[model samples]
Target: MVNENREVTEKIINELLHGKICTDASAFSELHRIATWTNPYVDYAYVDDYSKKTIAIIFFDKYNDNEIIKENTVKAISEFDMVVDAYDVHSLNEANFYLQDITRTRLNALPISVIVYDSNGKVSPLNTISISEHKATKRTVKEQRSYWCWWRDGSHFEVATLLELSQKYDDEQGDIYTNFVYPEFFNLMIEGKTRKWDGTPRVKKYSTSSYKSEKQNYKIPMCQLGLWDVETGHITHKGESVLCVIKRYGADSKEFFDYLAKIILIDGKHLDLIKDLEEFQKNNTELIPESSSEFFILFDDYMTQKNSIGTRKPTAQKTGAKKAYVRDEPKLWNKLGIVKLQGKSRYYKSYVGIEFDWDRINEILLADIFGGSNEKI
Candidate 1:
């Protein structure tokens, strides 16, 4: 499905470049719509510069193949430099990231505002698209980064230097045999190497706890933590507190319960916890009812001092939390594979809900992460 989307996108790009899709306000708008369907994270806007020249504004978020879009945009910019003025490429995550700074228009908006920036530096809006009016029902790109550092040995260590030293040990061994080196000597060696890399003191001043936290928290690229109801076909949350929802609803919904169990097995790696949860369900079925509100109460009760271990936060913390979680949200859970919410019968007002399409989501989840081994041009 990713391949199919890419193929469709490439074809559209070719047509647009070759004048097959006549370059006009309407044409660009049409292209923007098509690109959004292909990948909502990629958006386009028309910018009429001070000289009355029209340029295509391409913006990319963390999601989708930003690198590919960038390469294509660069090529298109060069091709259209003389033909359609100059194309501008911008990163959504970086600062000064918008074409029109006055309105603070987000790049993700569909039919993104068509505005003019004059030589006097005055910004004027030509075509407007309201961010409030259009509500994004599906999971959209929340963040982006090129690389993430991980401990090579897979040992879960919280301290930054400890993890880095561990990472170095595993990395240095790379295909070589492991060793049991003296702790003092190894620490000295690591300190020397660290100082040499940045010409800093052997004992680094700042805390790397934040960096280590980011990597260990299971927040990986392109992960979706959103939870959807299997029967109602509604997304309970979009990349939010899904574990809480699962722990609450797992007993009642087989689909939700199964996925939650798998995640706990894969992420928590605590067979005993799963056993306890199953046991609890069997023994106290009436206490921990199947309803969503009841589920929340049961989960809270399960978190008390007596059951601290079971109540431990799932590796995937709620959105906007300080620390990260165990592993990326099961990519499969992101796709409920059904049409989204048709009504609020099962909607939780406190939490946002998105409609799900099971078949469509399955296609997306099953698609190759690298989009079918295609080489970057």
Candidate 2:
């Protein structure tokens, strides 16, 4: 019976790899059952030919033993040089987003071979699932929506400024932003010492409202990380704690930057990515690129595997992840005294320094922040 099942599984996988859509629900179910028996946590599995590699995407409703699943899946497909991407999605919409991202097709237009298993373990063809019943409201051609990407404008200085500014405001009042915060921040930027522009000191003027841009770039992210109150625009206890760190060790200091890294990793909810990158670096040392642009290509693959869903288009999803990695996280690393930018350009050529000490810094930061607890912050 085991021999027969193994034969059946191989046949199904072969068919999938060759672009055959398995419409027979029973055969797909059997394949799913066998995959589940191999790793009980798998919620969905599908073959992807979107890229150069023949890839298998395994979905989970909750993250279980991710390494075990990847190991077993690799062993099962040992005959082929296939790549396996595993994602843990919390909602049906989130799962649907990944499906659309992988296939570059809407949920209603997906290939039949893509099977979906909901939280209750009910399996259905990918094409049959409806992400939304109501037709999307159409806008005029002139009123089209802009492509979405992860916001990445905030820096440590701006964050510190906002936090310090918040300390002067009453925490209970939510209406302090428009009247006080915006104008005050604008003056602070303009009236401050002349900043260097292209090797010359130049007096700067506010191009747009500082509040509008900073609110999106700084306030929203700070709120998301629990440093600022979303409604009140006041600093939280967490934010205050971070402010103390900033005051003790200046914003540019390594101690403060390490704390920022910890906050961004734990409170910003990116610990999983750090852990995954650690493993990826260990295994794929030869694959790591010297240039930042080239490095982002490799990063995007892992981002896709992790099912980092934000934008509507697959291209946007890739672009957005690359932008965040380059602009936000690595920029922070560059400031942390660990990562040294190589070139004169805003986006540097390499992160050679980060390659060596990333795991060490991550280990120390995680241990310090979580107090050695394995639980997700």
Candidate 3:
């Protein structure tokens, strides 16, 4: 019986390698034969194109007992770039176990990681799932795919297989965007020229203030703030999102700019500016030199007062002066074309501006500095 079982297993393995049992039904038949070994010489069997070059055969029986046959087989197959577990069964009774596992896993599709930047300049991670797919084409052979994100209605969502969701994102032709309307509505879509459809992202804005009022808001991790959506595999921000927040509140008052300062350090896109703030935060003793450039001087005062409240002297007056100076600085940078500052503001002061042109500063921002003209702010 054992000899017969070994012969059957070898034949099945050969057939798998030769692509004879590639379909789900044929693979199951082969696995069943190995599982029904009379002397328990075979444990399980499976076939897949895990090696990339061609189909690979994986099987186990009582003859191999030195290592975990199942675990080793899975690990080996997973190492390949593309693989599909065609069939696996440990015993005759467990013939349908593989199908059941697939069903269960699909019900809870992989958790997606979404990092959102709040108005307060902090980053928070929100896990969202691909809930459904919107058909982008009617053709039978080559259908286009699109996906709908699981709505963030403060409820747990069940996951399921939505292949089109992946295909639509993969087919993105231009820059994608993630826009949050104040507090509730959050949208993600590809930009106009590169977008395949004419769908507007302005969905109904949800009201979460009541919920927020009841719960304390926790700060998001600073590291996850950028535009990358790891779950969907896309680079999405298309406009001046948090920058608008800064422009509105940054220079409004000392209290507001202080908050904006923190936001910039925590979630700012400009790599150099973020580093400067982080350095200043680490070393509070370094005073802003009088001869330093204007931006540095203003930035130093901002950091010194923001981080070293109790330790620094003349807190009130210094803070006040720095606040007054910074309120008009964004306007100056705008007039000099240092940055494409979008909002409206006025600078009534009359003095000779700094001798150098401020264009170099535009290079540092969360957005791509030299992006195509079609790209958004």
Candidate 4:
């Protein structure tokens, strides 16, 4: 037990040096860009024959000046606890830059316990603890591919999957962003235009999954992939979704999409798009449009119609001039899709996905709620 204590503390120090420790849900969503390392407490670790659970940590450069770190870190741990079988917490105030980092890792272990520190330096939040061993689900690597969206309302979320303005977003300020919103992380797309995806010569020599070299085993990148939608949420085909609180109970595809369909981007098309958005908002409305036409928003003009302001779309638009904005017949906005910012759409703004999974990280969160195995997705 004494040796175990030493080992755990050593791991905790590593995590604090590299992982993000955040408290806000929306903030974490945006922290997707700044994260340096992923901890098992939030990323995939172990979960049965299929499905990997995840936990995310947001790192702070100076925790004292930015005291929110304590709250955010605590919130992160609690959220992970609810979804994960178990996790670990440690401070790395003593870490040196030359060494390796290992912050916010979750490990599967018997006799698991939560350790919190007192302002006075006392650690170990639990006075009495219970530790238990977990048997592996014996799932093969391929069976680990499945996972669903982590709703905004869900207990904890995976931040590695979305795009944002560096931080969750500041509704009051126009385009004002937090420090974490933008980081110097190497963006592959932006880099590919100038430099190769990776700077390493060996990496350049090897083809990515899309272009596998007959010489080696490689995986294709999922950066441009779509969001996961199981029974809980719907992943848009183009993959731009404004996450909202999820209904606690699970939902079917029809019922789930119904919720998203209500919140469609109704503003932005040059001419007409509101008519379709208004109808799409209704729960009972059947909107199985022809497959040829993809869904989209017309623009703020749709909201200007006094009757359309807060209510759902008109039951049906009057064919002629009476229809302020017409839901044009058949066309999808593929050229440059729109983005939702401050409850409105910004036309022609593109989006991409960012994922954080640590098959390479050595630690695993022993979170009991999620079972002490590494969960993947």
Candidate 5:
């Protein structure tokens, strides 16, 4: 079916090129309508025998669907041998604006022929095609703050261990995990020296290839948090600063938690828990759930409502949210003393509700850490 459609399209293009108007109303009617349309953009390509290149005729109209325009532009480049783009614009100002666009400016370096199109759909072609050069605009990277690592079982110690190994070994090497990380983990496990932040002995199953793929959970979050330089496998200055704080004041200390909160919130690269917390506080002032399990139910409900409004990414599933917010983030916070866990046991199934330290939370939210200097460290 697709091949037949392509063949028909090719036939239509050939007919149009040869100035033989297609008589098939069902197939060629759209082409004639496009040529006469005052606003809709048209893109057609043909080979130039002299240059042995394919030339793309792009009819630009501001009223056309941007996505369609982009798709047609890309299609012309990909289907052709070597694309020499010719833009049809209404005025000089429109041409200038199109050339200034960061994405569109890339086509400026290609040989371009300008055609003036009036409101009446009359085409006036230029005598000379110009090959010009323009500086490409630098695109800014957008900072995203969602879809965090959902590895609920691992702690900061494991993360620290990975960072330490990355510093000694080049991450670019394929054998870094097999040669370094797994061996070190094996040594730690055998010695019975594996411990959590609070000096608690951590016993877990280990294998040389256990974390080969799982390591991405740590790597992605560490890079997002500005802790590790994944490219170089070295601790960034930000990572170094965090390590210093950990050395001076233990991981369980308030100082360490404060630093974590600052980066997690201010950097805006992980979960937007602060915003969620604020929204929860605003709506449920009288009946705030204290238990982690209870809180999870309410948070899930809140997310359901939020999702209905189409604010979140399509991939942000309820299960993912539960892992990131309910299990992972809360566990970290509880360990660092950012949010105190009450009850006989700190285990998820048995533990009492988490006690929110509003004063500290408020203070952390209002902190001006990056007010003037933008010093992440």
Candidate 6:
């Protein structure tokens, strides 16, 4: 669908660069409500500067690839360093106060304010056509750099990091090698030598637990932890993400599950815990429900308990309780960590999970500790 406002904007920019141009203010004021089929939401505005120059503005759908529009719009205004502008879907119904500062104006209002600056003495449609061709060259001339941002998220650790990330599971340092993140921690496990964090080449060292109960736990590990990619701007798990270095190899479900669960519960509170729970079940298809009634009730109780903690001093302790139960014990059996609310003897919130030895994820090892490969840029 043709964005009439944007179309008018292009026309206006073309004219303003040519010379002084104006529009009928009364004609725009007549429309009641305006929108475009491409992406509904009449969020367009006009901006002006202290120098009395005016500009038309519009928002776009994130996926909207208005190649010509962006190129031409940038080209139309490029010569005028007097006015800086941008188009994005992020701002909606927000007025550009400088133009005439008042949001009462709707987006359907066309032929918006004047273009105040014009560096081009004889810019024409032909030049606007050239904008696309020259844009890449122009951008390269501008300063640029590449920074490797997030590649994985908490989800990645379920497979590797849980082995080493847990401060409480410090006793389980021996088991960290099996951590899901292990494979990717040192250069995607692609082609590099693992190094100690202190610039030293590294290798795994074995451990023997003094506690007999520890012997009953899973075998010790022999790998490293890694990172996952997050959204471009958001810094936390709330945004969309995926496994990065951890997935350089295949995946380990046990580690993946543990990492994912921690992230969901870490925030403590969000829009609705139940909503996240539902999503969890939908994503991890491995979980089997042993006790539905108890699980639901405890989940609600956990929600209440989670909220109650705010009134008290902050600490890892929650209402003086820990959740730990085996499936055959009782329907109302208690478990600890975030899954304390489960009804079954064994309470797992979702099918996906990391096989945490209930003790290892938090262990701190004083053994001749070794680091892995250095992260490359």
Error at 40, model 2, angstroms: 28
lDDT of 3 at 168: 35
> Total clashing residue pairs per candidate?
12, 0, 3, 48, 1, 44
> In model 2, how large is the Cα lDDT of residue 221?
67
Model 5, runs deviating above 4 Å: 1-151, 170-179, 207-217, 230-233, 244-257, 268-271, 284-294, 307-325, 340-355, 362-377
Candidate 4 lDDT over residue span 1-377, tens digit each: 11232233334333222322212122112111111112211222212111222233232322322234434444444333212111222343322110111123332122122334423333332212221122222323331221211111110111121222212432323322112222211122223311211222122222353232211111011121222221212232333332322232122222223223222211111111322243343421343222211222322242333222222234423333223232221111211122122213322222211111222111111112213222111
Q: Please identify which of the two predictions, 4 or 5, would achieve the higher TM-score against the true structure.
A: 5
lDDT values of the candidates? 0.30, 0.45, 0.27, 0.24, 0.45, 0.27
What is the per-residue lDDT of model 3 for residues 1-377, given as tens digits with 9 covering 90 to 100?
Answer: 22223234345444443444332222222221111111111232222222212122233233232134334433433332112222222332232343344345552132111122222323222222231221111213121110101111111000000111222354554322121211111212111111111222323223466335212111111112332343332332411333333345442233333232222322232222333333553454344333324544455476444321112135535655443322333332333244433235322211222222223332222233233121111
Best by TM-score: 2
As for lDDT, the candidate ahead, 3 or 5, is 5
Q: Which TM-score value belongs to model 5? A: 0.45
Worst 10 residues of 5 by lDDT: 31-40
Q: What is the alpha-carbon RMSD of candidate 5 to the true structure?
A: 17.1
Instruction: Give the alpha carbon lDDT tens digit for every residue of 1-377 in model 1.
Output: 22222233334344443544333333332221111112222332121122222234342322344344444443443322211111112322322233343235343333233332322323333443323233222323232211111111211111123222333344343211113212432344346532321234344223366334433232221121212222221223421233333344432344443343333222222222223334445555556544445544453355332222222244335554423221222122232222344354342212222233444434433333223322111
RMSD of each: 22.6, 13.9, 26.1, 23.4, 17.1, 22.1
Model 3 steric clash pairs: 41-62, 42-61, 123-220
- TM-score order of candidates, best first? 2, 5, 1, 4, 6, 3
lDDT of 5 by residue, 292-313 (tens): 5676666656654443111234
The predicted structure with the larger lDDT, 1 or 4, is 1
TM-score of each prediction = 0.22, 0.47, 0.17, 0.20, 0.45, 0.18
Give me the runs in candidate 6 sitting further than 4 Å from their true place.
1-12, 20-57, 60-186, 189-377
Per-residue lDDT, model 6, residue 344, is 47
Report model 6's TM-score to 2 decimal places.
0.18
Model 6 per-residue lDDT at 117 = 19
